[model samples]
Target chain A: MTAEKLQVAFTDILKAHQRISPYIHKTPVFKNSKINDLVHRELYFKAENLQKTGSFKARGALNAVLQLKEKQTNLKGVVTHSSGNHGQATAWAARTTGLQCSIVVPSYSPAVKMEAIKEYGAELVECGPLPTDRNAACEKIAAEKKYEMIPPFDHYHVIAGQGTIAVEFLEAVPNLDAILVPISGGGMIAGIAVAAKHIKPNIKVYAVEPEGKILEKSLRAEEMLWPNPPQYLNTIADGIRLQQTGHLTWPFLLQLVEKEVFTVNNEEIIKAMKFVFQRMKLVIEAASGAAVAAAMSDQLQKLDKKIQHIGVILCGGNVDIDKLPWF
Target chain B: MTAEKLQVAFTDILKAHQRISPYIHKTPVFKNSKINDLVHRELYFKAENLQKTGSFKARGALNAVLQLKEKQTNLKGVVTHSSGNHGQATAWAARTTGLQCSIVVPSYSPAVKMEAIKEYGAELVECGPLPTDRNAACEKIAAEKKYEMIPPFDHYHVIAGQGTIAVEFLEAVPNLDAILVPISGGGMIAGIAVAAKHIKPNIKVYAVEPEGKILEKSLRAEEMLWPNPPQYLNTIADGIRLQQTGHLTWPFLLQLVEKEVFTVNNEEIIKAMKFVFQRMKLVIEAASGAAVAAAMSDQLQKLDKKIQHIGVILCGGNVDIDKLPWF
Candidate 1:
């Protein structure tokens, strides 16, 4: 994609912030006195874990559905595939805007997540594990039924909505030294980096990933591809354990992100989750835990003591109670 | 205690609020859309679960410390016996105000909680499980060292400090119809009930308890005693599973509380914790969960839906990661 395309994406992000402000939570920002002592720098957490639908997915989903214009007026329905948070977001978005939603999912998706989707009144389309199969089925269903296929990450309006985090963060704490965001399909970080870097040219943007699912490999290699083969996915940071980034998200990330860091194993994520819970008293999901773990550990060696103030977005808090590791 | 004595206690509560405001968090009140639907009433959670040191204990501890007058100026240290939240609160309170703290903990206290006490620079004293034993040891230590003993509850200053919750809640949500509090040593509820009923006579005060532990029975029986003594504390709601209520607390509660209710079994607490974590996206301890469980199960059968707007203090969020049912 060209630089002009990326700029349009950034512009759409600004517009999305304006459009979705009424529906979304501005959510609270907190500084951890306990974690601050350990990190030796002021750490601010944007609590999207407390966001409606328990994740920032609400921002993108609402933005995407609302941005559909006259050309897409004949949209028969909204369809997307997600294991949990995104499906719930789509269902909520559809319900709020008076539309039918059909969320395609793998047959093996967690029962707890399925229950949430059903609770939100989303029609389910269970399919195989392969992303190719799921995408093909969703596309075919959209073509046959005249449904508007809502790509979870690889869409302009979705990125724009996710970008609103940057706007809010800048408004909340204007002179942030750096921001560490968890990376999955690159939707959240891609949007945040674009808006934050655009608004404050000197501010640094960092992407944190689970050890096994390293998207940083692709970003640092200057290639638009996953580091390992397509089949590698083993991490407890389930939300960000993606095999690849979206077509719409890669160029924005490559252009905007200052650095991308990988955290330790699931053990580190668990440790960080426990540390934040015990010290900060904030419940954060594993993806959010990865960002905190990266910041707390030696991954950001050079920037550790120097960054005067840092911001981390707690991306979501939709863990299955039964599946929670502690029990 | 006489009604006039209770009136004087209310006056002390007012004084405590002024004393603790500078130190404690006037935590935000939050509402969950789904929880509202379940209860069939508008529920506002007074997020004391998010307070400094992750519980409303901070208010009481800070109050007790600050209430130390000129005569107590020779106090070499402050002593308290607690297994968890109260100990952490005292440790934090002592550190914040530059006072030495000696926390006499039961030998079985979680290492995590013990670490928090040590982190705050409190001297840790390990004792037997029973409060009588721990209290006696603390008393002896206080006598030997000329240190002031800060009782968890029953102490006028402690109750007055906890009363700050009711003051803040009523101030923030002026039209609250009722306030439900989890009863342990009775300090939290006694303090809140006195403040709430004193300010607004019509506002109902309900105290929730785990069925296995019958402190409520003792309250109804008009006695300061332990009831249905645990074979060993089994409920996951460790924070509220106190062996007994305070002597000073029971008298205040007898006059102030409108009703007392109890919930049984680990399943209910676990289920409530799950609901709060999933629906509210808030990290609450089992005591808070017990209150939410009480709200959901119509534990207060006598109360009507006419109590439209209610406030529940999510009293604390200090659970051991290893001990959390959902992990």
Candidate 2:
């Protein structure tokens, strides 16, 4: 991969799928006619919220660790820093291979997410709520414990791993006109855009962000944006509050994503979450809510033309019910 | 269909499947390793929660209405009384065929449920909390409006409709040792038992109820028991809190179900709901929780020789998130 390009091929996603099929679930494509009527589009929801570890992170996390083991013989363990699903997923992936995993979590991360990381038998390290602090903690752990650091979104294998979701999704509903993906550190959408665009050459890949639309700014500037991470934390979509896109992922975003980057606020995301929870009977995290909220937004009709069929990825379902956003 | 017996033939369920395939979803069968480890058996969860109107009732309600249209000349409308999922389902089924539907509900039913009935364009009739009041309201509406009464669980068509779930469940995983069904009006279990027993004759069918163990009591007495419905209202599983099994359903219960009818308290049901909501990432109502609770119970391990593969029907997912049981 060059500085201005994403070299992660469709074959890599296919390989990732082949390697992780036993470990991950080919989550069902779900639809609610009520939402379809409101949006005036036939929307197919790729339900990765029902995936193992309750997110699509399991595929990427497992693929990265499994591929790492395939390449290196003396890998003692793996270390990574994430606030939510990725931390838990990496821990689960490590446990599967009998490898020790140390997950550094932001102190602001929900207790339910932390508890899951601990339940997977990972060494839980809590740090201050900043991307820099998380990175420092992971670096320190990797240096001292001789553990290979698995950066959440900035790696090739991780992008390829997440790309597998697109393969399964397109195969399920081949006629989808586009796919709406929720963006955090850009890995999930980056991977999705790569595979989805490859499969359906004319398919539009729309990136949805919370109130803080850093990706949009980055795309307009033709460079990755790095805003204050705390500024992005106001939204209830806790999983995708990271400030910057990855070096490797930003290029994919630049090339593959639709020009119009969609944005929804905390209220919109919560509304989408509630709709799915109450009507559709699916528990979706705030990040997934971004995609759902965007799907239901009037902006879809305001597009260059009406999209007849669309696919929305439900990224995760690890929200704290006791502390529901609406309540 | 005699008063003393259930004759919901396997062919009835098969025909029901063919009739309602376009209207209802073939809900996915979900399994979690963590749940499997806790239960010490492989449990396939039939996710009817994701069905239309967010319950398995859609299958039966649709089958009844569709079959009614076929058999009758001019069907004015369909009417039924239900406190929750069934009412919403019947309203949705009627709307599908552009048939006028009047749903009678007890005053205590959640506003979300009542709103759903209205949203589906059904005439919402609110009655007193007594089951008798609900029945009287339905009878009054059915007579005055010339609407055919589609009872929730007692009728042959409804039984056959609910049985379609068993066909889908067994077809997905044919080698199941037994199916754990959450019982309310008993039509669902009766249809399931007939279809499942016909498919796999030795397959055990276990009935799980909330705090009120009326099914166990009725089975012991060799007759359908009639207790006051209000006496059994002190449980979180509102969907299945009805007092007695249907006349037709009771005979199937006596002949097909295992001798032991397992019962769980409200606490067990809530715990199970939380597990599914948090870990499995599915929004399951308390009726589904009864089957889930039974799966995780200690009594499952104590059963005569370990029954390895069990299909647990997740009856519905129409709980009010704002008023979750744990909260």
Candidate 3:
């Protein structure tokens, strides 16, 4: 895809903010003196963990659903395939917009997550525990029911919706020198980078991912490197375990994101999660931990000297209590 | 003790708020639609867990230390006996004002709690596990060092300081029909009751405590009832395990507080803690959970119909991760 075709304009993000203002929460920016002392840089946390549906996915989902509503005069429903924050977000967004929604999840997906999707009043369809199977099921449903399929991270409206976070974050802490966001299919960071750079051209945007993810390698290769999911996915951060960046998101990320994608180990992610819980008094999921870990990692040493203020997006807090790593 | 002698004027609370304004956080009042639906009342949570030093104890401690600094010219230090939030709060308050502070904690106190006190630069004195032993140690230190005694809940300044919470809460949600607070030595509730009642004369102030604790019984007897700690105190809420109400605080409770105190079982407290963690995205200690549990309990059935808006004080979030009851 050419840069011109895939480009997400600053105006799109601003429009997304205006469109989703009533539906999504403008999550608070939290700061801690102790954390600042430890990092040697002032840190502002955009607490999307406290967002509606407990993730930044709510922003994109709501925007997409709302946009769909405006575009289609007779909206039948929306369909997505996932067993994560996105599924819950889509379900909640559909419910909020008074639309029928269906989520296709793997049969092996955690019961708690599936229950959450159902609780949000989404129709749950169990498919085989594979990406291909899940995708095929979603496709079949969309074709059969004429439901608007909302892609998790690759679509224009979704990316635009996700970009709204940066507008809110920059507004809250206008002087932020840098922002760290966790990358899954690159939708959130892609959106954030586009918005942040547009708002303040000199501001830096870094994408953080769990170790063993191939996003960094693909960025370096200048080509999409699809890792075999079962073999390569070893990180505990379930949210960001994508094999490859979306076709639409990859181009935007290549142009917008910082050159080097930061990666943190599971141990570092767990430690960061614990730190936020203990010191910051917030319960954040492991995916959110990756961003925090990257901010505090040795890779940011050079940036620390230059940047006085850093913003990290705590993307979610929907961890299953029984499965906490500490236990 | 006569009510006249221990009376805490609303002006004193206002003065405490002014003195501690810079030293403490005016914690945000959080509301959840799900929680509102569950309780059948609009519940506003005063998130003191997010407060400086991780509890409302900071307010009282800072007020007392600041008061002592203003009153005495040769202020050597301040001493208090606590194994929980108060110890850390006192140490933090002293450090903030550049004064020496000593905390007398039981030998059996958790190492994590002790480390927190020392981290605030306070002198740690290890005493026996009994209340008498801790008090004696504090007395000895105060007598030897000429340090003013900052009682956890009994003193006028401490009560006035804690009363500041109500002032802030009422300001945030002015039309609250009732306010719920966890009672330890009756200091927090006493302060809140006085401030809340003084501001909104007809507002109801209810004290919540762990089941089997004698605070409810004491309020019923119209006198002080000190229970045997080892025999009667079996609740997981260690923060509010005090055997008796403070002499100064008791009078305020009798006059300003509502006729009946609410109590919840340990099981209910754990359930509330988990609920807040999962739904509210907050990690609150069991003491905080007591207030939440009381608000959601069957005991609030009659009050639920009458009270449209209720405020529950989330007292603290300083829990040992390894010792979390759920795990």
When sorted by lDDT, best at the front, the candidate numbers are 3, 2, 1
Candidate ranking under DockQ, highest first, comes to 2, 3, 1
In order of TM-score, best first, we have: 3, 2, 1
Instruction: Report the lDDT tens digits of candidate 3 across residue range A1-327.
Output: 555555788899999999999877888898988888787899999999999988999999999999899989799899999899999999999999999999999899899999989989999999997688988999999999999898999888899999999999999999999999998888998899889999999898888988777577778777787745523367889888775678888888788788787889999999989889888889899999999998788888767477889999999999987778767
Q: What are the per-model C-alpha RMSD values against the true structure?
A: 2.9, 2.4, 2.1
Model 3 residue B95 CA deviation (Å) reads 0.9
Chain B TM-score for each model?
A: 0.92, 0.95, 0.96
CAPRI class assigned to model 3: medium
First chain TM-score for all predictions: 0.93, 0.95, 0.96
Candidate 3 DockQ vs. native: 0.75
Candidate 2 local distance difference test against the native:
0.87
Any runs in candidate 3 off by more than 4 Å, and if so which? A1-6, A227-232, B1-6, B227-232
lDDT comparison, 1 vs 3, better candidate = 3
Candidate 2 clash pair list: none
Stretches off by above 4 angstroms in model 1 are A1-5, A8-11, A69-76, A212-217, A225-232, B7-15, B69-74, B212-235, B300-302
